[model samples]
Target: MARLYHAPLSPFCRKVRLALAEKRIEVQLIEERYWEASPDFLRRNPAAKVPVLQLDGRTMAESSAICEYLDETRADPPLMPKDPTQRLEVRRLVGWFDDKFHSEVTSKLLYERVNKKVTGQGYPDSGNVKAGSKAIKYHLDYMHWLLDHRRWLAGDVMTLADFAAAAHLSSLDYTSDVDWNRSAVVKDWYAKIKSRPAFRSILADQVPGFRPPPHYTDLDF
Candidate 1:
């Protein structure tokens, strides 16, 4: 069995977890506080990041690389499209959520409201929180636009792109930061993805000192 060093709410970790679960790979979940920079954890990933995956007698870092590797090795229920163009689209959307959305929304909201508290950094910065709140509306609207024509974020098929987007949304959803009422299309897309069996572990996650909203685990929600 593989071992995964992860923090439950970290979007990057969640992305890797989802990919692994979707591939039906079993892994031992070892929660790591990367912020402390312990020697063992640092050796696994010198960058000191959550979601260091130990598999096939090798350690792997970076969620995208790990996920792509799993997709190639497992090859069943593929997470990435076969066509080059579609695959590029999937990668583009994955980057969009992990990088752009993370910087604009997650850093401002999750970092302020949850990460800071957990890391003992300080109280939530109201300005950053407010900015995240506002920025999410635009993202939600864009999702609505995408879903209006396509069945999934990148294209017709459910790909790594969906998991990437969901990974970020789930973190915000845990803290009750996402407004599901903002767009029915986006909400419907989320509901479909959230109901998948691969999402079970993510839905079951419990962060210390932080309680998820009641709707967090609701399949119909």
Candidate 2:
């Protein structure tokens, strides 16, 4: 079995967790307070990231790298496309969510709204929260545009791209930051992905000071 040091609400951690669960790999989940930057945790990941994975007799850092490694090693249910072009698209979308979307939305919202309280970082910055709330509308529109054409974010088949997007969205959803009514297509796409068996563990997650909205666990939601 693999061991993962992760923060439950971290989108990056969630992305890797989704990939691991989707591949049917059993893993031990150990929550890590990366913000604390303990010496032992620093030894695991010099960057002091929440997701440091121990698998196949090796330690892995970085969510994208870990997820791709899992996909390559366990090719039963493919998370990436076989075609190079399609794979590039998947990677691109993955970067979009993990980088652009994260900076614009996740960091501004989830980090302010939840991470601050959890890590004792002080009160949420109302300006950043307001910006994140505004920025998400644009992102939801973009997702709507993508879903209107492609069956999934990158293409017809669900891939790591979808997981990447879902990871961020799901984290935001946990805080009731996502406006599901922003786009019907985006909502439907989320509903489809949320219904997957791989999503069970994520849905079951319970944060100590936070209670998810009722619809957070509702598959039809």
Candidate 3:
């Protein structure tokens, strides 16, 4: 069995968790408060980030790398496309979500709306929340454009890219930050992904103070 050190609501951690679950890889989830920068956690990852994984007798850091490692090591239900072109597209979208979307949306909205409260960091910043609200529209439009052409974000079949995007969107959804009405295509795409078995643990997650909307767990939504 694998052991995963992760923080609830972290898109990066969720991405790795989704990949692990999708592949039917059982993992022991250890919730970590990386914000505290504990020495033990620091030894596991000097950067002091969540989603530190203990697998195959080795410790792993970095969500994208851990996910890819799982995909390569596990044969069932492949999360990455085999073709070079499609692989490139998948990686691109993964980067887009984990980096650009994270910087523009997740960090601003989820962090403000949830993380600050959890960490006792004071109230949500109005300016950051406003910016995240505005930026998500553009990202939803981008997802709409992609889904209009392809069945999934990268290509015909579901890939790591889908998990990557879903990780961020789901975190935002937890705080009711995502506007499912912005694009019908995006909403439909999310509905399909959210209904999957891999999303069960995520849907069951309960943070200390915050609560997700009812629609957050509704598959039909």
RMSD per model, one decimal: 0.7, 0.7, 0.8
Candidate 3: where are CA atoms >4 Å away?
A: none
Each candidate structure's TM-score, on Cα atoms with residue i matched to residue i, is: 0.99, 0.98, 0.98
* Candidate 1 lDDT tens digits, 1-221: 99999999999999999999989989999999899999988999999998899999999999999999999998899999999999999999999999999999999999998899999898998999999999999999989999999999999889999999999999999999999999999999999999989999999999989999999999988
What tens-digit string does per-residue lDDT give for candidate 2 at 118-218?
A: 99999999999999999999999999999999999999999999999999999999999999988999999999999998999899888999999999999
lDDT of 1 at 35: 96
Compared with the true structure, model 1 gives a TM-score of 0.99
Ten-residue stretch with the least lDDT total in model 3: 73-82
Predictions in order: lDDT: 0.94, 0.94, 0.94
Candidate 3: lDDT of 215? 94
Task: Please give, for residues 28-75, the per-residue lDDT of candidate 3 as tens digits.
Answer: 999999999999999999999999999999999999999899989997
* Candidate 2 TM-score, true structure as reference: 0.98
